[model samples]
Target: MGALVTLELPDDSPIHDLPWIITFGPLGDDDEWEPVVCGPYERPHALALAESVVADEDLMAVVEPLLPRLSADEIRGEIAASRIAAEDDAVQTEDADIYGDYEDLLDDEPGPETVQQHAEARPAPSPEELRAGMARIADKLGNLSG
Candidate 1:
């Protein structure tokens, strides 16, 4: 198994010397970091953190420009993508409150009553709607090259 590592600051470490990167997204209603990069950190650590985190649809990261690495356009694109993702998550949260847990109906030995309740609830978006939303997100993320 691969050894798990965390990028936390040393306990009570002074803030100035320990420059690090932060990757975060909106959770519930607040913004929060998913992974924090620190400790003798270099460009490689920032790259690795970015790679690990890009899988999340609504997060972005920033490290101090150790050597003027990222261009202005690149940073603008990242900001746009993160904003779009945050909007999507907000919509999804509202939808979930309305729809409840649709997947729960698929569990083993689900009661007929429960199934009926799910069936009667106003349905979530169709697959086509989901595809459309994805296309919109893709169109919004101009700087992200697949």
Candidate 2:
């Protein structure tokens, strides 16, 4: 069973009124967990929501058993793997600068312009769909608890 923890924030934009960052994790396999992000949100808000999800009684009940099996090194490795890599951008920029006037070199031959076809926008999920998804998550947690 997979666990989900979401952080949501309100926005004025009609396309995305409530943006969200969802952590779908604690999967039944060894795959690394990553957040499903949409719209715009602050880092602090995401952290707060994750903390709240961790503190939830039912979630904790489902997660507690898994905690004991994890070693400190494993936990650190997960953190390192999941963390964002802003540091790499600096290294990439430095490497590009190694070839003096590299930016000018690329301008010599501009690639052909490609036309992108935009897909038609779809409507948001119905309330029933949202409820069903939540119910499914609850069921997974319940099953794990037993």
Candidate 3:
């Protein structure tokens, strides 16, 4: 975790944290040659993570697991997948229909209060749905629009 700072409007002028912030972390004791979190070098387990990031595997000795035994529900992985999905902005045939349906049913709802409440009441995806969606989304959305 990080510390929390609270500010009151009564302050003369509250400047945001310069909008952009760059943070650096010190390396660990045993990690002298390696920057586990980040650095100029690629990840220590680059060969292993190649499964997730690399295009070809034969170049490497063998395909390796990036981070075995991951919880699968970790927020960090979710965030990364979300970013990748965004970069793959291509759309699927069904996606437009899905978006239109969502907009019509929710965005164009009859009442503001009703739509707001429905938004809050929406349920999280079930584990099965999560796994299925992840499998499909991990494909780089190659089937989506160009």
TM-score of each: 0.27, 0.22, 0.20
Q: Write the per-residue lDDT of candidate 3 for residues 13-94, one digit (tens) a residue.
A: 3332111112122223332231122111222233234333323321222221222223445656778998888766745536
Number of the top candidate by TM-score? 1
User: Which has the greatest lDDT?
Assistant: 1
lDDT of each: 0.52, 0.46, 0.37
- Ten-residue stretch with the least lDDT total in model 3: 16-25
Candidate 2: clashing pairs of residues: none
Between candidates 1 and 3, name the one with more favorable TM-score: 1
What is candidate 1's lDDT per residue for 29-105, written digit by digit as tens?
Answer: 35544554443344456557655665554554454432221344555688899999999999999877976766866
Ranking of candidates on TM-score, top first: 1, 2, 3
Clashes of 1: 0
- Candidate 1, residue 143: Cα displacement in angstroms equals 36
